[model samples]
Target chain A: MSIALYFFAGLSAAAALGVLLFRQVLYAALSLLACLLSLAGLYIVMQAEYIAVTQIIIYAGGILVIILFGIMITSRLAGKPMQVSTQYPVIGSLLALLIFCALVLSQPAVTSHTSDFSTNHWQRAGRWLMTEYALAFETTGVLLLICLIGAAVTAIYQRES
Target chain B: MSPVLLYLSFLLFALGVSVVLTKRNAIVVLLGIELILSAAILNAIHFNQQFPDRMDGQLFALFIIVIAVCEAVVGMSIIIRVYRYYQTAVPDQINELNER
Candidate 1:
């Protein structure tokens, strides 16, 4: 289990690096897909069964598709591979490294690492969502509806104006 | 386990920040945002494992997933509209509306 955990974590980090380094838009998007899948694997190792599946379905499956569409529609077919412009590469990376140092220095110490990846959380999560997080669930539904309507309106509104 | 996972999350978050700052394409920028959110979500899951019975961390992660979805949808739509209007997906090139 520990080995699987480390493997997925390493895979995720590597794929994320690919996303960072890839200059081509399609390649970066594909790298993001790999990163997300490896993240799902990490979630599984961490006993987050629901999140693992959600990460795969929603992030990799759904959001990625939308991003692909955006890429396709926006890009011109001028016989050129779609490449994203890199701006302030050195400064951005330096700032990111500074932020990483801060995060590491401020990280909470890990005292007890639990190996409790055995219990099934599907039923428990469902119960809590319906009861304790009931308001949150309903609000999410409303937010999704609003997002659905809003995205449509915003996207099409510009065409007519 | 906990320390490794937390460090991994931090690494991803930093990478995401760099992606957002360095990339010019709207889709790639959005992807960077997704990476940032996912990193934070991973942290929530890490804590969820710590206090399994409380279930707060997991629940928060779930809500964040929903929020991320909404953000992607809205952001994509805005990107689409911007592309339609300016005929370019690079945010830096959109200078008409900028306060000069």
Candidate 2:
């Protein structure tokens, strides 16, 4: 299980780098899919089963498709690789590395303890969402509705000159 | 286990920040934001593992995921509108946001 966790972590990191490195929008979108899937796998390894499933269904299935459609519709570089302009790669990388090192150095040494991975994550999550988090869940629904309407209006505004 | 997980999430978050900083394309910028959001989800779930019975972290992660989807939808629609109007999706070249 730990080995699987490490494997998915590496895969996700590599795919995330691909998302950063790809010069074309389509390629970057594809890399994002890979990253999301690997992250889902990592979630499963960490006993986050419901989150893993949600990650796959929502991120890989839904969001990725939306991004791909956006890429196809908005960009005129169809069938041709469009060069994405990236500035200050060296400085950006240096800053990121600094942040990474700081995070690593700040970590306290692990206290050895056996993790209890009993399988009620989904049940409890559902209960809390329905009970304690019911208000938040309803708010999310409202937000989603607003987003849907807003997106449609914005996309179809069709300003007349 | 926790230390390694924290490190991975931090690394991912940093990479996402770099992508946001360096990429000029609007879609790529959105992708960077998504990456950062996912890194945060990973952290939330990791913390949840510490107390498996309490579902607050996982529930919040789920909420974050939903919000992220909504964000991406709205952001992509806006990007489409920008592309239609300006005929390009590169942020640096879009002068509409700049003060004249």
* TM-score of candidate 2 on Cα atoms, chains taken together: 0.93
Runs in model 1 lying further than 4 Å from the true structure:
A112-118, A157-161, B97-100
Identify the leading candidate in terms of DockQ. Answer: 1
- The top-ranked prediction according to lDDT is 1
Task: Find the 10 residues in a row with the least total lDDT in model 2 chain B.
Answer: B46-55
Query: Residue by residue across A94-148, what tens digits does model 1's lDDT show?
Result: 9999999999999986653564556568988899989999999999999999999
Error of 2 at A28 (Å): 1.3
All candidates' TM-scores? 0.95, 0.93
Clashes of 2: 0
Q: lDDT score, residue B44, model 2?
A: 82
lDDT (C-alpha) at residue A110 in model 1: 61
Model 2 CA RMSD to the hidden true structure, in angstroms: 2.0
Model 2 residue runs over 4 Å out of place are A108-118, A157-161, B96-100
